[model samples]
Target: MLYSIWRYRHFILASIRGDLKGRFARSRLGAFWFILHPLAQSLIFSIVLAEVMRTRMPNIDSQAAYPIYLLSGMAAWGLFSEILTRSIGIFIEQASAMKKIAFPRLCLPVIVWGSALINHVLLLLAIAVIFLFFGHYPGFAWLYLIPGMLLISIMAFGIGVFLGILNVFARDVAQFMTVFLQLWFWFTPIVYLKSVVPEKFQFLIGLNPMTPLVGLYQDALLFNQRPEWMNLWPAIVVGFVAVVVSFMVFRRASPELVDAL
Candidate 1:
């Protein structure tokens, strides 16, 4: 698969480039628009909930803490959700190309990852600039974002490919994820601080694989502290498992894909 991907690298890169430019091509914001949704969300959440949860939120002792904290969590969540949501429909959207062209089908997922990675990096810088706006500059701990984002991307890519393949059979899978991701977003503690959640309810949040990952982002970017790797390995394992499952599903689906489509 890797060799196949490498063989078709030019096509994948071109597709990704087209995807980026074609998005918001007429708009002034263009790619900056990628940062708007999360940035707006962070502002609103901070304005409404910041004071209410001020004393309770863990890192809210500073004036800029809540926004930074919220943005960091959103950054992690956005990357995963963007890939998963877009991936679920990749096959459907690319049906014409897949049927008419002779390119590697796996290139679609590669394009999604390439686009999402660029989006996340842009969002990260946007978040950092916003932090400066609030008079806080993130420290060296921000370097942790590289590994942290990569881990989350693995999980997102795996799930995206799995769902993208599944959606080729049942269109409803795409519809279901629209609702599911909303619930997933709320479950992720992007707005409310995890420290504020009660002990009994912590287990529910823990069940969410993204919880620790989001916490790790907050710890690194917002708190300027190192993440505890002991807690992160479980999510990493889940990511690996998802990748394995994705490959299995891809192998199974590729054989009948044309007929199914």
Candidate 2:
């Protein structure tokens, strides 16, 4: 167990370094795109959904502040969705490296999650700037976003690791995940607050671990409130279960993964 963790740690560092290098390998702005991509998405979504469309369901109260609301949710959703989507094909893409390298198979998704995290951090910084410009700087409660971000990453990593390994034997898993993530984005409270959902539907939505995960971010950043412990506990539990199951599956499949490639 200890050895696996150590090996994964080494591979994670190496993968992160490689990711940063590749991310800016040819760009003049270099790492700046990390900030720009999310910011651009937030800007466009905010404008189209909040301004031009003037869209809001019947239940949401803060229609005026919906842009920041949606931005907060989208930031976390984008990270998870991107990692989940990309990690699907990681083993196939790195087939040569996997065949030759002695590193742990688990490291592939971790690396992708780590790189996505860099982008998420940049998005958070941009969110802070946006809030400041809007005259709504987040308070100390915003620190909760650190733990919230960690939870989201763990959730993404667990799912990604499972999918990455599975993709080796079933190429169709990657294609399915792309469409699934698109449907998932809407199911999650990215554009609408959970409060807007009816009480009966709330439990169904809560089944998706992301519902509470985004709630944590919104609580910390947008509302300046502490995370709802009752709401967050389920997502944490789901994430924990995902990690254990993913690790077991990945470990069992690692030897086969190399052969499949």
Candidate 3:
């Protein structure tokens, strides 16, 4: 798979560019739409929940703390969700092209991953600018975002490809995932602080693979503190297992994928 991807590297890059172009081809604002959703969400939450949650932020002293915290979590969650969402339907969406064209099937997920990564980087830049506007500046700890986001993307990509293959066989898988992701969002503590959750429910939050990853983003960007690396172990383990399983499933499923689509 790696060799095939490398051999078709140019095709993947072009496909990514084409996907981005087609996404905003009709919109005047173009790429701004990418950041607008999350930015608007951050603003709405800042207005509605800031005061209620501001005091809950233990060590953060800034009045903009909650907004910054929200954006950080949003940034992490948005990337993971976008990849998973797009990936789930990619094979079916490209069914016609897949039937007629001879490109590697693996290329589809790679394109989704690359395109989502570009959009995510833009969102991060927007959040960084917002941080400055709030009189907040990132320190050395901000570097944690690199590993943090990489881990997130890998995990999302793995699980997404796995689910994408399953969706090709069972159409209802797509619908179920849509509802599941919405619930998953609330469970991840993106809009609300984890510290605010009751202790009895804390273990439930911890069971979520995304909690530690999102917390890493909040710690690094919102609080300007180094993330607790040990916390990422579970996500790391899950990501590795997911990626390995995805490859195995994809290899076994590839023969039947086009027919199902």
Specify the highest-lDDT model's number.
3
Alpha-carbon local distance difference test for all models: 0.87, 0.80, 0.92
At residue 213, what lDDT does model 2 achieve? 86
Model 2 scores a C-alpha lDDT of: 0.80
Model 1 error, position 225 (Å): 0.7
Best by TM-score: 3
Q: Which is superior by lDDT, 1 or 3?
A: 3
Ranking by lDDT: 3, 1, 2
133-227: candidate 2 lDDT, tens digit per residue: 77777799988888888888888877887888888898999889878888888889877666667898877797888998898877777678898
Would you list the clashing residue pairs of candidate 3? none
TM-scores for all candidates: the values are 0.96, 0.89, 0.98
lDDT, candidate 3, 67-164, per-residue tens:
98899999999999999999999999999999999978999999999999999999988888888888898788879899988999999999999999
Give lDDT for model 1.
0.87
- Clashing residue pairs in candidate 2 are none
Q: State residue 228's C-alpha deviation in candidate 1, in Å.
A: 0.6
At residue 173, what lDDT does model 3 achieve?
Answer: 89
Q: In candidate 1, what are the lDDT values of residues 102-168, reduced to their tens digit?
A: 8778789889999999999998888888789888888999888888989999999999999999999
Considering only N, C-alpha and C atoms within 3 Å, which residue pairs clash in candidate 1? none
